[model samples]
Target: MGDGLLVFDGRCGFCTRSVGWARALDRRGRVEMRPYQEPGVPESIGTDAATCSEAVQWQGRDGVRLEGAAAVNALLDTVSGTRIPSTVYRVTGGLQERVYRWVADHRSRFPGMTPYCESHPAECAS
Candidate 1:
């Protein structure tokens, strides 16, 4: 099986929904989602809010990294090889960057979007 990485927010409802969808689509079980906040994940793999919030990252064996919309597209390729056309439609690099920025800018409305800090709302930018 080809190794596929999925980086996501543990506390985000949307992120969880995406994860569930991934699981359902991944019939071969190629992709694995690891929350950015999960303990024991290597720093090199971006176990931090800034990195996770910046983009979805997919890391494969030998550290092949795919970021932003490409990461999401890679996930689809892992789960549904036949849906390559669909993945391409959703994951244009420039468009993905814009989407990622929008998500980060207004993350509050997102369910389970934990505020970055107990004392400050801005801290939960992850």
Candidate 2:
């Protein structure tokens, strides 16, 4: 019901593009974004860095937490004038998660940061 914070992978180019899209759509600036890798962020978000690394996360002013596609839906919730579409998208949990997982699985192929994962390929594989 208040400000929404989205924590995402800053190093991934794909993730960066996605954040830009969200920001562009939300003209009201209702959503704020921060990289999960930022210091003191995970603690503030009531999560750990490891979990945030795996998927996106969201925190509402009411203290509700959502992850992955659900976190995305939370961001979408503040598009200024897309309530119905957002509700519909939010309700489809299974489909959203499947799509999110698929994208995450292939993040390197998407429009994102370079060197998606150098030291550990598995880090970007999932």
By lDDT, the best candidate is: 2
- Writing each residue's lDDT as its tens digit, candidate 1 over 44-112 gives 564555677666678765577777667777777767766674456565667766786687566556764
The sequence of per-residue lDDT tens digits that candidate 2 reaches over residues 1-126 is: 247888888677788778878889988878878777667777788999899989999998788888998888777876655566457775788898999999898988876544324323444333
Poorly placed runs, candidate 2 (over 4 Å):
113-126
C-alpha displacement of 72 in model 2, angstroms?
Answer: 0.7
lDDT of 2 at 82: 55
What clash pairs does model 2 have?
A: 12-113, 13-111, 13-112, 13-113, 14-111, 14-112
